[model samples]
Structures are given as structure tokens and as C-alpha cells.
Target: MTIGKTPPRGETIYWVNGKHPWVSISDMVEYGTILTTKEKVSVNAEKLFGDITPTGTLLMSFKLTVGRTAILSIEAYHNEAIISIYPFIDNEYSARNYLFYILPIIANLGDSKDAIKGKTLNSKSLYNLLTPLPPLKEQKRIVAKIEELFDKLK
Candidate 1:
């Protein structure tokens, strides 16, 4: 559970175009898997950003548009407004699909207590958030059920 780097600016920033996929909140889609972003940076920027977020990482935007989630399908660097999670680590009571469905609800429920702007969710907000944690098997079952129900809507 690490937040993204501060965006590069001034001479430290280089537009490398495709060498590095840089994700910002706008690039994320509802329940989408992100393989490429609308922006990119050079190795210089990556160094400044500190890490090449590995593929398959689960990411959620915790800023102004709180709780928009996505899984990275390509190695990428994202802005400070996002946080990346190692899926297999705490992916326990949380399924990617489940989070996609639940986080926004939690964010909305606590909006009045957050920063005096749009509902911005941050690490502290995350730590304070209390959610139901069923067994891992039940989580998987719930995700499957949600998907099945959504598929029926198509």
C-alpha cells in the first residue's frame, strides 16, 4: 500500500512517449484494466517517480475522484493521487471486483468528514475505513455473484 510519486516538473520532466506509461486519475476507467495510459515519461522521470509499478498491481485513486480502481496490465508510473496495492498481499477481504463495487460507496458515506473539497480519500481515510471482511472464499463467491448479476444486465 504505497502512494504514487509527486509529478515531475521543470527540467526533471521528459516526455519519452511510450517508454513509460504514466497514469493519472483521468486515465482510469470504471472497472477497467489499464494496459496503457494517455501519458508517458522518460527514465529520468521514472527515477524521480522512484519505481516502475509492476504489472498486475491493483491501483485505486484516493484523491478528488476517490476510489476509482484499476489493475495495471503494463508496468507503469502513476501520480501522487493514486495508490498501488500488491494484489496477493492484502487482496484478502478485498477482491478487485469487490473493491470496484464497494470503495465508492464508502467514500460517499464519509464525504462530509473528508478534506474540504471533493471527496478525497487518503491513507488516513483508508486506515479509518471499517468494512465487512468475510472469509476469502466468501469474497470470491461474492465477486462471482456480482459478475454473474452484471453479465445478466448485458
Candidate 2:
């Protein structure tokens, strides 16, 4: 949603109190997994915020904390501090798992800028962020390898 069109806090009546996962930067962790969320909104709030971002959408924190990333296991809504990135349609190379792994690196590029309040990667900066685009097969292989390595670490 646009900055000018942000829903006011007084609209909490639309919040269903745990019906829809509402994510914030505070919910992000370094492990790249969004296991749970403390906030939720009602269906009305979901409609107001466009739509619930689908499960598996990659969420990245760009404001204060800068490079935290996570994959949404449940469909959810997120505040402005988090940007929900959906895989590109018709692009075989657009793997959500692969993007989850690489987005933190892409987010780090925006960390060079300084904001008066805190480090911020504005919408324009986020829109302009570049990412690697390996072939679909290669992306799947990379994701598998990463998972295997992570399992080994566990």
C-alpha cells in the first residue's frame, strides 16, 4: 500500500485477533524461517491491505534491521517495514526457495545508504535492487544443496 494510503491505527476493529498472520520486522529472525507471528488481522483488514501475501512468498526486512529474510509458511500480511516478494510468473528461474537464500545479499547492497531516522531501503531502492537469475534447474539444485548442508549442520 502507498504511504499516503496507510490504514490508521484506529481501524483495529477490523483486526480479527489471530485470524491472519500479520508480520513485522520484529518477527524476523536470522535463520530465514518465520515460524510464528504475534499479530493477526481480520478479513476486512486483509482486503484493505490488498490481499494476504501467499504462503512461500519471501519476506525481507529493509528498514532499521536491513537484511533479515524469511519464507512465509502461512499466508500473512506484513507491515511497511517488510517487503513481500512473490516469485515471477512465467519465469522458470524464479524459485522462491532460491530467492529466500539470495535476498539477504541483495538487501545488503542497500545498507550503504544512511537514513536520518535509521537505515532505510525505500520502495524505490527496493524496486531497483538486483538479484541473480540462474536457470530454473540450477536454482532447484542450489536450494537442494543448501538444505542438505543445513540438515548436516543440525
Candidate 3:
């Protein structure tokens, strides 16, 4: 996915104070869920950013904070710090819940470079990060088991 260009500061107020939720890296959580966000974008901003990320799209932050992941429960737009993953084919084999659980583990395997600023995972490195996928039934079972355990913990 291509990163959206940042709107100039002066124009941001108008472009972001509208109906669409605008997500930044700050909106992501290690727990693999995003409940809400503080920023929003106008339709024009959405146009500039390309398509709205659909509900249940998995989001991962690869820069700065590095390993944060989340699943959007609502339609939203996100900044460059995050990349949205949409499962277009074989939905049964690619469950969003399962991916959410797996992304943080993948992030740890990413190639990290220590620059003058901070640790970052370049797009190429991120693309090359390996992920394990089980059979569709197993994936669903894992997700269900995770939920069950979490519910117990709660």
C-alpha cells in the first residue's frame, strides 16, 4: 500500500475535521485492537489518501514504535506510519483476527536498522518479513481459542 501525503499544517484543520476517521501510528495498540481515534479527515482528504480502509482491515506500524498492530473496527484512513492489509481473496484462509494475532510476531522478525533518529523497518524489509499461515480451519480454531482464553482472563 502507498503512503498518503501529509497535508500541510494550515490546511490540515479543514481536511481533517470531517466525517472520516484519520488514524496515525499513535492510534495503534499492542493488544491488536483499535477502538477509536482523535483525528478525522474530510472527504477531500480521503481523496488525497486514496481509498478508505475497510472495517476489520489489519493495520501494522512499521516505523518508530515498530511493532504495534491493530484491527480497525470501523472504516478509516491512516497515515504513512501504518500500512493497511486487506484480504481480497480466500477470506476463509485469511482471517483478520488470526492476522491480528500474528502481526506482532512478524514485526519482531523484521530487519531493523538503527539510524541517527531511531529504529525503523524499511518497506522492503517489511515486505520480506516471513509469516506462517496454517490451514483455514486451524486459523479459525486458534482465533477462537485466543478469544476464549482472553475472556477467561477478563
| Most TM-score-accurate candidate | 3
Return the TM-score for each candidate structure. Answer: 0.82, 0.79, 0.83
- The digit string of per-residue lDDT tens for model 3 on 61-147 reads 777877787878888888877887765554653566787778777887789877666777888988798877787788889988988
lDDT of 1 at 147: 77
Q: Each prediction's Cα lDDT score?
A: 0.74, 0.72, 0.75
lDDT of 2 at 85: 70
lDDT of 2 by residue, 39-125 (tens): 777767755787677776778777778867787788778887787776765254348778778777877886346877678787778
The residue pairs in collision within model 3 are none
User: Candidate 3's error at 25, in angstroms?
Assistant: 2.0
Clashing pairs in 1: none
lDDT of 3 at 91: 69
Across 12-104, the per-residue lDDT of candidate 1 in tens digits comes to 446744478989988888777897788888777765777688887778888777778888889999988888865353454355556666666
Worst 10 residues of 1 by lDDT: 87-96
In model 2, what are the clashing residue pairs, if there are any? 16-42
Best by lDDT: 3
